[model samples]
Target: MTRPKTTPLPPTIVVVFGITGDLARRKLLPAIFDLYLKGLLPSQFRLVGFMRRDLSKLEFQTLIQDSLTKYHRGASSTSLKKFLKLIVLEQGQFDDPAAYERLGEQLKSLDNSLGVCTNKLFYLAVPPALYPTIFPLIKKSHLAKACESARAGTGWTRFLVEKPFGRDLGTARSLERQLKNIFTEDQIFRIDHYLAKETLQNIITFRLANPLFANIWNRGHIVRVEVRLLEQEGIVGRGSFYDEVGALRDVGQNHLLQMLALVAMETPATLTAASIRAARERVLKGLKLAHSDFKESVQRGQYEGYLNESGVAPYSTTETYFKINATVTTGPLRGVPFTLESGKGLPVKKTEIKIYFKNLKLIPVEVESGEVGNVLTFTIQPNEGVALSLLAKEPGLDYLVTEKNLEFAYATGWPDRLIPSDYERLLFDALMGDSTLFPTRGEIIASWQFITPILNQLNKLPLTRYRRGDLPSVS
Candidate 1:
């Protein structure tokens, strides 16, 4: 008999752990509401928020509406108002036992009302300290257990935890083991939202699909790689937290590192994620851990605390930004230092990775569009998008390179660009029990393998100070 094509289910319910926190307000809710407005949400979908906020259901919707209007980019007012109706709020303590039971009931009612066993997606957006107490609580609450039961007709449940997965290698490993022991590795989905950006995802696809580009994606043709992240604003509310996390963990270890892996990883045997990650993981391990490479390729710093932020401790020694340059330790490109910059305060509101071909100075000039050299930049945030910036020949006959850009943002109706929130996508992946995107125990261990040096240096030594609003890091 021919196997039937099993239909996939749309999202039914999302339970956010820190529903009232900054992440929930700034990114999660806005992205979800945007997903809803776009007609992507299930007809029976609902949002079940977990927080200590003392507010009624209507009040929570009001809170989310305010954020959707104020912070959501490319969102329509009418669409947002309609989305408010689909959201259902639940007030409960994150760590309390009774709270877990209350949450279970809330999910049950919504799932039953939907006429099918609905999905239970947990977004752990609370502080890192709260995860230990909350994660197991989520599991113990019978929600996580339900997901693992695999009984026919039972609803799926998934948990999405935020980063700072752990402070060091040991913690990261232990945490992964713990989570996996409870939920299959396939059941957990990690969200390094940068992966969802079309440009980064497109890096391999665009290169391979086009013979023009794929033919020379090797040492024979390429030169240096530059990863830059700039933030135009100082740490407003997350200074202390960011200070503890630092740039290495803030962006480098996760976003930048992930991007570097995607760009530099050997062409997988195939497009299958396992094939790609197998190649990527090998590249990550090839990084040089020696002190010399450490100094030249890695850097750490804290921006001078602003006067009125109240976030910086009077004697705080935490660093808010960092820059790193290092080469991969294995493969054809070994010894080529990959430079990365991450900072708390800066003049430009951008995060991008620019791959310079041949040399930093001589970029490929675009014959048309009045451009010179080809530069690919993946832009994340302010608006989620990607821009292909190339240097073109000067308008006159001179050989000077001019710059031209072809950008794709979510608002323009790019299909993949309209994917669900990083949280939503990860949660959905988790409920479906897929761990392809989430970092594995080995990957987590590997992340800290190279990352420990920077962390140790931060704890053992004084940080090099940087001016607020300066370029995050440098050569």
Candidate 2:
């Protein structure tokens, strides 16, 4: 890909919440450093760290170094040094009004001394429990007011919140209300990090731009849509939270559904961020989780438990895998059943969405023909790229056709440079105040509304089961 020659964004100050955590050290800082090294960071920018940690500036930079340097081998020392000097640390705790005030003063002092504008971006890298406490704290601290007073005209102040939007629709609604007090609908950036991936972003573009797909991307021509999010390993030590949320809340509600949304959304007249979100919002709002409604359309399962993996566990019933046969009620594909499949302990590592194209194969019939039709599969992980399988000549006698697969690998034909991690890319966007990759309020609300029914069903029925290392399927 050619380097994009574009003007830099307005100078901005980035405040990272939970700055000392794994997310900040591993992803946020590296992404920002990459942008800085690439000359993409604005000339007058400040990347501030906020959390309970009492690390000095040098110590904070060291924290980022220990994790990010190994992952971002391409980064230069000079760029990291420049970024570190611009970075600062401030201590703040949830529900503390004075801490927010002091943090605000730091932003003010930096703006005045550095001659930087007051555009501030707050990243809530903290847990959801901290959100209901911190949002009101920011509102009370007058950081929102500082955004108003900045010379840059309605000084840009936006907040980026991590996912697991809420436990259910009611809780999600409450969380939104908590944020509504301090930030406008547009001021909040809820991240489904998967949405920020290059290939994930390329989904609709790959399909809509090509006439071969746009013409037949409907129930009339397509038989089914299979969307999968697979991981080769188990939950590891993150079971404290994963046990409660399970696969549905962790990957199902957001990422898998997001892919389905992009595949199922119609061709909007235009593809602006707002327009595209509007299309997604329409699909989310129409979601009704009646067990009877989708008796055939939806399926859920959990992987073999940690305590019961033969000798892996003595005996346990906790599920680490799940599958859902979701039906979207929005866009041109409304009422269309999209198979949402994912597993925690799969046989191998693979994440792809297979689009079942109808009848392009000239179907196997008479003779020894082995035609199985055509399918366009978009793989987002492991071996990243697109693959298409279709019937082809067997190179033997006439009518001796056989099934053949063709793949276009994105990783193969790219530049030698490494692509930033999904978390890195998203954090960089937040720092630069580009909210296009983040999910909006409408999208979050719609997601919660769609997920509420599934949660209710899970609570009512707990035997959802699947074997370890088993592939995910609707059956």
Candidate 3:
């Protein structure tokens, strides 16, 4: 558990849009607090929370305090107080030009106090619809540009956008064009929090570092690859948003597909961001539906009583669950069936990738009824870890074989240290200008290209109904 040594980050200012939203309260604020506690943040850092809510400075501070207590427990009262002092809240509507003007002033005021032009990192915690409204405001106010006149143009500005980039390929491209107008591709960080997870990142290290598994990571040695992301809770108050995006666009296009790329991608020339991203882009560009017919390659499902949910259309055919059988048309995994499944209101909440290896031919020993081949699983949540299932001979007079699992849990393996949350890792990376964990524009477009056709045929596909706590049966 040796850690990499790193230089201290530069003085910075982080402005979070829609800071009053659920994502900011539950994840962003807490993660920033954790970084402060760990002394990983720069000493001259400032946090600006932009929202439409009309609250006093004290009230906003209280709100952040409550949020931190609830989402990120175990912080010392003294440390919490000190962190709150670094926060500044700006109340304004997204569409108001005056609000953007005031935001620019606030940023300038902070810089004046610090006597330096600090780097700016804007985190769009709001929905995708607000992006069009916000991006232009940022540009109009000169908030997207570096302060070249001040401090010899040492400062930089970057935007960290959340997932569900767009509804489909067409909309995604449109949004990309808008983003390009405001910021360069290098300055935009399209975040897929799943990619920041330790276990998912380990997939690359585990495969390449060990010759035992790396040699057999091709279609010749693997039977199939399954990526499952199931949740026990329904849309919960996001019915309006969920109804429009559905399961495939919400999770399948980004998280699930990214996982598949990591599993199917070839060894990178180096571990740098450019090398790894290039490898991932190659896999995504070659992905396609496994079958010619949509029905055979995709399955859609909705939880029973979904129509009764508030904000949901009476006859909405939106799917809360989807299972797609995709194939990598090129590379070592060409023609390999990669089943990607995700759903809400399932019996259990689990996220993992299972790689089923091809069965080995037995010649020297006679097997007495046992499952062959190995199943390598990388659990991404609930309990983050990796497990390998293998057949073992039972100790007895009679010959018997049983499936045994060799497992490693992060909690148990790293008992002495706290594992950073996904948002924490991602936010830190953005501040450090590390795009290694973030998906590139090419990756996003490639994923959308593969998903747009499936989305177009949703009308012809049948949506199966399942109980709230049951798994949907898919052929």
Candidate 4:
């Protein structure tokens, strides 16, 4: 495989909204440092952290330095020094219009010093509540206005928004409206970090680039698709947030469904963002679940003793687990059932998609039956790689068929790999003005549409409760 040549990026500034937040400390900052160490970041690039904390620029630098040191042990002090030199801190409340104006001035100064009108990527790492205030502030401060470089067909400005886009369809639409008023569809990126995972992106290339899988990736050969994202630990400190937004919206609606689309979407005409997103949007719109199909097809659950957890309401009915079966109405995989199951406090942590292909049942000779189906599994976590389970006769005698897994483990097979965190890849894409892995507004709304019904019916369905150390009893 040939690597794409690294094109030198124009000078740019990345402004993080929630600089002091856990996400920035643990994921975003480390990703930036990694990019810098790899020489992927432009020499003229700068990082500006915006938060309401009353910390000085030096304090903010120290905080980021501590975070990078703790989270990224592999990063060297030399590279860290170079990266830290790029840091700048600004203090401001999200609702304060004046703060945005100050930020605008700071950006202008940077542009002037760089001798070019630089690009900007605003990453809203803050809470959803702040979105309303921040976006309008950005618009009013003229931050969203096209930069001079943009007019000359050089620079670009983009917004990288983190999800849950909204609680449901109505709110999702409202957020969409808010975004459109400030930024164009092409300029807004709804970041789904799962899409940045190596295996997740590889799904497209695995299908289109390889004729062996592409030819049979259809309903005729595929029986059922299972997407499972199980976690060993429950929502530890996110009880307040998790309780309000249950498993369905938290994980099933976005991460799980995103994987399903990648698995079920047809081959795009071209590999561009527009073509790939259009294909995904088509699949999302084609997802069919009649109102009556909810009971038999959807299953909800909760881990026992959730109410006893700190920050949870007494007698909380919020589901800690969710599983739903859906069918696609278009493309070669139409009518193929997609079963998506996700939950916290499961037996073990694993995120994978299992494509169970039809077995060779028509074979004349009968062998002792086992799990005989040809299963293609894309493991996204714990062990990130692809595996194919084929039926093979057991050695020495009695015709017994067994499953043999031929595996490609990313962590092992690809030794000395420089795989970046999902944030790194996503932030890089946003900086480079690539929206391939980012979800579009249409895709977001369509996903909520597919999920809203199940969420609405969550109360009516029976939610099984199991021990924290065990998988949900619903299965």
Candidate closest to the true structure, highest lDDT: 3
What's model 4's overall lDDT?
A: 0.86
Give lDDT tens digits, candidate 4, residues 1-475.
1236466888889999999999999999998888888789887999988899999778887888889999984878787887888988888989999999889898898889899888888889998877888888899998987676686656788889999899899999999999999898878989899999999999988887889888899898998899999999889999898889888888988999899899989888888898999889989999976235568888888888899888889999999988787889877798899888999989999999999888767663443544557888999998899999877778976776666789898888888886779999988887777789999899999999988977887899887988988877674
For candidate 1, what is the lDDT? 0.68
Give residue 254's error in model 4 in angstroms. Answer: 0.4
Which rank order by TM-score, best down to worst? 4, 3, 2, 1
lDDT of 3 by residue, 47-102 (tens): 99999999998889899999999999597789999999999999999999999999
Please say which candidate is ahead in TM-score: 1 or 2.
2
lDDT for model 2 comes to 0.72
Q: Can you tell me which runs of candidate 4 are displaced by over 4 Å?
A: 1-5, 364-369
**What local lDDT score does residue 143 receive in model 2, on the 0 to 100 scale?**
77
Predicted structure 1, TM vs. truth: 0.81
- Expressed as tens digits, the lDDT of each residue in 157-266 for candidate 1 is 66677777788887887777678767866446667776666456667776678795677666655666777777877777876676466667777678877877777777
CA lDDT of every candidate: 0.68, 0.72, 0.90, 0.86
Which candidate ranks first by TM-score, i.e. highest?
4
**How many collisions between residues are there in candidate 2?**
4
What TM-score goes with each of the models?
A: 0.81, 0.90, 0.96, 0.96
| lDDT (Cα, tens digit) per residue for candidate 2, span 225-294 | 7888888788877766666677778888899878877787777656667777777777767754424655
